[model samples]
Target: MSQHSENTPILEARNLIKVLGGNRVLDSVNLDIGRGRVKVLIGPSGAGKSTLLQCLNFLTPPDSGHILLEGREVNAGSKKELCSFRQQVGMIFQDFNLFDHLSALENVRVALMKVRGMSKLDATERAVAELKRVGLVDRAAHYPANLSGGQKQRVAIARALAMDPKVMLLDEPTSALDPELIGEVLTVIRALAQGGMTMIMATHQISFSASLADEFIFMEKGRIVEHGSPAELLGKGVGSRTQAFCAKISELTGEADGEFRS
Candidate 1:
C-alpha cells in the first residue's frame, strides 16, 4: 500500500446526537479517524452504526452536533461548500443502492458524468477500470436484477470508487448476500483496505475488520462503549454486553470475529 499523505485525522465528529421517534439513536458520539486508515465500526444489532455513518456523510443530518471533513466543518453558510463536502464523502449500503434501470457501467458512469462533468468516453473508461478493480469488469453491462448479491455489491463499491471520494462509509455491505457470496464482496474490500483507503466501515465481518482495521469502535444502545485496534478489541475480550453479543453471533456464524485475521 502507498503511504498515507499525512497522519492527520481527515475527519472528526464531536458530541454527535440523533433522535428518532423519541428514541436516542446516537448520543454524544465522538470520533477522530486518520487519513488512509480503516476504521471498523462493530456491535450488536441496532447499535447506531448506520446512524453514525449517515451523520458523518450528511445523509442524515445530526440533530445537534457537527461533522468536520478534512479539517473544515459542514455548515449552513453556503450550498456550494456543502455540495463540495458531500461529493468528497461517498457511501455504500447493504442493499447495493444501484439504479434498477441502469447497467453496472452506467451506474458507475453517472457520477463522473454529472458530478465531475467528465466526458462520456472518459467516464466510461474510468468506470471500466473501477469495475475491473472490484472484479466486475465483465459484468459492466449487467443490471442489478441480473447480477448476484455479491456481484451487485461489488458494482456498488465500484460506483463509489468511480467518484474518487476522499472518504468512504460502508454500512453492512455483506449482510444481504447469500452465505456463499459474502467472500466475493469482502475480497474487494480487502483490496481497498490494502490500497490504504480512508474508510469508516460499519460491519459484522469481524475477521476482516480485525485484520484490516486500524481501529475498531464498539457501540451499544446509541453510544460507543469501547474502541481499540483489531487485536485489542477481539483478542483480550470486550465488555460484558459486547462479549455476549459477539458470542451469540459466533454461535450462528461459527465465527463472529469476522473478516479479521487472527
Candidate 2:
C-alpha cells in the first residue's frame, strides 16, 4: 500500500458545502488527497463531482468549509494568499480554456509571465519545455481554433504544468474529445500520474480511473458514499448502489469490463 501520514495531506477539504438555487450541491463533503497520489472521483450525473473540484480550487468557493493545501489553511478571503494558492493548485476544465487568439506556446508562456512574473525570454523557454512535455512542441504556433480538440487540451495541460503546480485538479479532461482523440490526452495524464504528480480528477472514464487511481471515490447527492482502492471498489466487494452505477456507466460507454489501454 502507498504510505501517507495522517497529520498532513497534500490537499484536503473539510465540511465543504455549496448551495445553488437553494439546492445543496455539496453537502458537507470532506476528502483528503496525499502527495503524489492520484484520486479519481466517479458518480452519477449531477453527483457534484465537478462542483467539489471547483470548490477545492476556489473556482467556485464553497458556502462553508475549510480548504487546506499542504496542511496550511487556504484563506480565499485574502487576495494575495488566494492568488498564491491558486498558482500552486492548477485546474484544467473540460472545455479546454485556451485563448482563442494566442498560439499554443503563447498560451503557456503568458501564465508564467503574468502570474510568476518571469521575463519574456525565460517564460518562452519554460513554455517550450512544458509544451514538449505534453508532446505539443511542434504545434506551438497553432491557435486554439486551428488545433484539434486533443491538441487544444494538451496545450491547456501544458499551460497548467508551466506553473509548476503542487496539485492538479482535472475536471473531466478527456470528456470533450472525440473517441480517437481521448487516448492522446489520457496518455499525457497517465504519464503525469506515473511521474508521481499529485492529482484529483473527476472523470467518467471508469477503466482509466480503475487502473491509475490510488484511491477511487464515489459521490452522490454531494456526499462521498463509498471510497477505496480500485481492487476493492471496482471488484466484487462494492455496495449495490456503487455496483449498479458502475454497470450503468459501463453500459453507456460500452466498456462493461472496464478494461482499457491508456
Candidate 3:
C-alpha cells in the first residue's frame, strides 16, 4: 500500500474542545492526518487521547470544534450527519467490546447485515474474510468468553475491518492485554499500517509507535503540545516534559529500542 498524499488531510481537527464534568478534556486541539498514514497519539492518562478518539467518531460529542473527514464537515449539530460520519469511521476500543452471546462470526456480520443492507450470505462471506485477515478464521465459531485476549482483540479488529471504513480510530487498543498478548494485536495493527490504512492510535507502547508511526502527536493539559515525525518528537533537545515522559516509559519497559537506546 502506498503512503497517502500529503496534499489533503483525510482527517482534520480544528480548535477541538471537549469538556467533561466541567473539566476541559480537550482544549483547542488541532491536527491533520494524512490519508493512509499511521499516526500515533501519546500523552499522559488524562491528556485526552481517548476523548479525542471519541470526538472523532461521534462516540462523545465535542463541546465545540470542526472535524473534517475527507474534507466534509462532521460536528454534533446534525444527528443525521453523525450517523453518516460513524459509517465512515470504524473505531476499535482497548477492550474487545464483543457481545458474549454472539459468536465471533456473528459479531462481525451483525454490523454489515444491519448497516450495509447486504444479504446474509454476502455478509457472512465478508465477515469470514475479515476474520481470516485478522488470523481468527478458525475461532469464528467461538464466543468471546471462550477466546483468549489476543483472539478476542483480533475479532474486534475483524469487526472494524468488515466495515470497510475510510478511517480507523483506536483508543489504547493494547491496554487490557497481558504483555505477551500485546505483540499479537500489534501484528494486526502493523499489517493494517502496511496496507496504507489511515489510522490514529492512542498507545503507551513507545517502541511500537517509534517504529510504526508516520507522525506523532503529543498532548498535555488537554491540548496538542507537539506534532511531528517520531524522530522530531523524540529528537535530542525536545521539550523537557516530552523527553521526561519518554525516558520514564523507556525505563519502565526494561528493553529500549527507541531514541534513547544508547
Q: What are the Cα lDDT values of the candidates?
A: 0.84, 0.90, 0.87
Clashes of each: 11, 0, 0
Per-residue lDDT for 65-127 in model 2, tens only?
999998889989999999999999999999999998899999999989998999999999999
lDDT of 3 by residue, 1-262 (tens): 2344556788898888998999999999998887788889998999999999998877887888899987778756788778777888889899989978999999999989988889999999999999999988999899999998988988998998998888899999899999899999999999999999999999998878778999888888798888778777677766545566777878877746455433
Taking the tens digit of each residue's C-alpha lDDT, what string does model 1 give over 23-111? Answer: 89999999988878899888978889999998887778889888887667778347777777878877999899898999999999998
By TM-score, the candidates rank as 2, 3, 1
Model 1's alpha-carbon lDDT is 0.84
Using all chains and alpha carbons, the TM-scores for the candidates as numbered come to: 0.92, 0.95, 0.94
Which candidate wins on lDDT? 2
Where does candidate 1 stray beyond 4 Å?
A: 1-5, 236-241, 256-262
**Least well predicted 10-residue stretch by lDDT in candidate 1:** 236-245
RMSD of each: 3.2, 3.0, 2.6
TM-score of 1: 0.92
Shift in Å, residue 215, candidate 2: 0.9
Descending-lDDT candidate ranking: 2, 3, 1
Candidate 3 matches the true fold with a TM-score of: 0.94
Worst 10 residues of 3 by lDDT: 1-10
